[model samples]
Target: MDTTPQAYRPETAILDLGDAFYDPVTPANFPETHLRFRNDRAAAEVGLETLGGGEWIEHFGRFEPMPGSLVEPLALRYHGHQFRNYNPEIGDGRGFLFAQLRDTGDRLMDLATKGSGTTPWSRFGDGRLTLKGGMREVLATEMLEALGVPTSRSFSLIETGEQLERNDEPSPTRAAVLVRLSHSHIRIGTFQRLAYDRDADNMARLVGYVLRNLYAEEPGDDAAAQLLDRVVGRTATLAASYMAAGFVHGVLNTDNINVTGESFDYGPWRWAPTWDPAFTAAYFDHAGLYAFGRQPEAIHWNAMQLAVALRTVSEAQPLIDILETFPERYQRAVSEAILWRVGVVPLDSTRDRALVQAIEQGMTQSGIGIDRFFFDAFGGTVPADDAFAAARAALVGYTARKPRDHAYWSGAPCSMLIDEVEAIWSAIDQRNDWAPFHAKIAAIRHMGEALAD
Candidate 1:
């Protein structure tokens, strides 16, 4: 009987924080509106599954207001270092926070956008996203989520009828816009901006906003330190998960690193084809700064930068002390992550550490396919080597978590290798055949269900 649109209770929490945090902006006018993808599952999480096609496009594509969501989108303000180069001017050039609402779990979720339109931050660049880029992100986020990495969900993708030029990929490419459902859009750069301005008051206010809205907790006297500690630990866990999933987030810039430790802005991301440490994702990253093996260090480096930004609100020594704990925490998180990928229960600290080392050595020396290696070695089995036997010895006292009878465990593992991704895109580009795309999504979700821990 409760058929009201506001039944889900959308809240403009970020707006309440004031306009200093962001700039009010308008969405772009596209020539055509075609709904390329709609995440009904994510919609259901925020109680919007009842929207029909026209309604979906109206809200997400045409930028029409939801019943009780934000009226004007907010282009967020923040500055970040790009490849360690401090760029004090970069913010959400094309994207903005569209709305804020609580999910089924009562956690505040952000409905945000990428390539929606230009903002005051858009300098010397057209505010648009390539359709290929949008599709890539949708696939990337879906696969990452299925692999159990904490990532933002690509909520909806609409192919705006326009052609765009780009340095990468072919020119005159189709353009699109994306809406993401995420925990928080606040990045390390958000604090970096305040620190750069020496705006300690706003820095403190930002910290308070993070604690209350993003974290759903009350702020304290040591809020910055507490937040930094939580962020560091979660970033460690996120780094370990990326390693376990064989993922290489190409751009590990401070702006891309969310304070919530939830990964977003999937651009130029790739799967490690093999176990090589120097495997780079983005084609432009010829120097391999953010490579597969070096991702942990890059993540740690970003976390430290977050710490540096927090220094404006906290003592330098105290923050450095918190940063020092990263190495030990990362070691523990990686051990747990590797064990989870192997689907084995932890026997003890020592045995688990040894098992992790064995797995790493096997990956390095075996030359097995990165995704295939995990699939074959699930449940502490396979690779048929002395090292793996020793790894199994570490697991002798415990049983596996995954059931053997699961249908997904029988055949090949769910994978998003480049070739498969290319094929999926090629279908869309040539014939507009979305069957492969839909099928891949279903398969990845099924694999996730099978591997649920």
Candidate 2:
């Protein structure tokens, strides 16, 4: 994993573990290659920013292998607990790991695809991704990055110009292909599959691979416990950041919990309209299992599942000890995230707790939109209404972290509320109008720059 970023340090390192973990597959050949989006920001990190439109289409849309990367795409194998029901038959049904490379930060990043084609795991379904779904994912990743959430970057999106029928969205919807850059594709369910098969050798092998490649951990007697601890902390921080950013990862299942702790696979994702904890993203979520407020609980439960799988190779007591630290870690991370969003230097634990309560209570009472609330509190002051008095009092002694003179502060905060999201998509769906979509991306990126430290 060379971190020097010299013309893309491509690697096929995942093959060292052999082909049992994934099946070599081919991508679908679409009738048309219509370019829709390209993320130059993400490409620059991996030294791929110089690709022309033809090269981009040739490599991403046509699925041609990048030189010195994976010779063939690998459809990864794993089983997951979908909505808490154990399903041992699920894996990368529609997508596959296309390539692996090192970025400028010395981190291992993966180039994977969605709606690319079908694979060995494509059970009873067409492995095509809807164009509208791809459009939504691009917007979701862009907005999440702007809001400072750790997430997979949407590197490329191309409309395939195919018509597919489905029950979820409008039938005969247009089709697309999506390429995302992520820290790691390894998930908790990856371990679950290994543990279920009782493949002790591969389990240990996979654990070592993760520890070295993702966690930068030394394979010692305590390596398993060490990796678990790091994962728990990262997951806690991710959950805390989501809460601060007002993100609801509609489907927080075990398979979706990447060991690196970045959020991805935006199916029914939504941002909270206000401070409503009961807001659901996926319409089928009648149980509220992965609602806004319960996200921390859902994340924690996924960590527990990881611990359960690691027990096959490590001591139970050490893993349990690490799991016990989630609550405190989550609380501290939440406080830090809130203070960061509020643009204030943090104080002691007691004051931070009071400030959290005050800000949340004020948000709940005032019904201010989440983005607007944070925007108005840029200098740690909201309206002078009595509902905000407690926040003002708790924020009295703190100093602002950054000056609020950026151009973004001169106007209302850019937001991704559901109606606006639909409007952006409807324009594309009805009239092929992409001006609104591109404009929103530009605004979101501007906001990200303004918020950058």
Candidate 3:
């Protein structure tokens, strides 16, 4: 084993917030370790590229503390309102924050695990992740990141030799563990937990910690309101990003929502097959509470819950004032995100909004696939078909972001529709073929790079 510490800038910032915020836990023992996936890009971010596959599995899968990193895995404590009902029992049941390191951008990033082990928060169920579940999250995160959503990157996945029973899918399936890299692991539920304990001083301390660490530019005197405002903006953009990408998060519980506004914790997530607003990802979401169209509402409601939690330390009216701006901010963000998706830069907000509305109407009336529409309509151009006539008219004055001579423009649009995701996984499950999965990831990354340029 390489005992030398790499260039990773490890920090115990979250741990410094005190033991009340988390509980140290032990990871479960798996009989075997087979590294399944490793995100090289994410590794480079933290300067961990020198660590080979064996070391990656040892640190991530075996739960061996990274050299010069946190001494013990911390299962973060938090409480969330599940589907709008307050639930004080929820926390990091199956996952824990393994380490914190700074990216090249000097931003704090967390390496959190899933299906690694059981913690005190594990309530009545085994703290294990199904291989299929890990596969789905890897796919979901890659696709979302490619689409430019502020989301967590799936870092490492390793098969843990275990067969676990599940109620949702095939029983006694293979098990695995996953690690995700994200901006922060702190959730709105973290504040709720503090509020539930009525720890006003701790609540105030947390607010200061977040402001100093996450939003270091902001003034500390009114940190609570400022944090809420920034969170609202980021959350609004998140909702709009989902709408533009045609994604339904399936579950938008406060615990699943990160305070830093990066989307993570994929469960039953799906892309809309079409432009239907009521499309849902989870099978049990009978009411479509977190449906494609209702995601903005769900996220805004979660922000409100954060505001409620902040009441333990700050004045309520200031927070409420920020909450009231969610609708306008979301509307603006949706228009901006839509324009970004179509590879067009905004010249006029009014014209862009009209174009967005026209595109939405065109998709709804023409029954075109959402991703296909954006793929075809890149560079502010519209299909010549009658179905897109309205959209074509709306884009008459708009300009493309740049020249559209990329080779990707000539290829079929990359999509993560349910059928495609399943096919990718099926190839691996049936014949141990990982080519399709890797090919899909490459294509997605290509699309992301092209968009970025």
Q: Compare the candidates by TM-score and give the number of the best one.
A: 2
- Residue-wise lDDT of candidate 2 within 356-429, one digit each (tens)? 98999998898888998999887688778788889888898998889988899999888888999999999999
Model 3 CA RMSD to the hidden true structure, in angstroms:
2.9
Which is better, 2 or 3, measured by lDDT?
2
Give the poorly placed runs of model 1, Cα more than 4 Å off. 1-7, 386-389
Q: C-alpha displacement of 449 in model 2, angstroms?
A: 0.8
Clash pairs, candidate 3, are none
Off by over 4 Å in 2: 1-6
Error of 1 at 355 (Å): 0.4
Q: Residues 1-453, candidate 3, lDDT per residue (tens digit)?
A: 654434688887887799989999999999999888899888988988788877888898898898777999999999999888899998999999999998877898899999987999999869999988898999899889988799999999899989998988777788999999999988999999998999998888888888778777544677789889989999999999999989999999999898888999998999998899889999988999999989999999999999999988889899999999999999899999999888888867778788899888888888888888889888888777787787888887677887678788879888999999889878977887889988988998888877774
In model 1, pairs of residues that clash are: none
| Residue 211 in candidate 2, Cα distance off native in Å | 1.2
Task: Please tell me which model should have the higher TM-score, number 1 or number 2.
Answer: 2
> Candidate 3: minimum summed lDDT over ten consecutive residues — where?
1-10
For model 2 the TM-score comes to 0.98
Model 2: how far is 140 from its true place, Å? 0.8
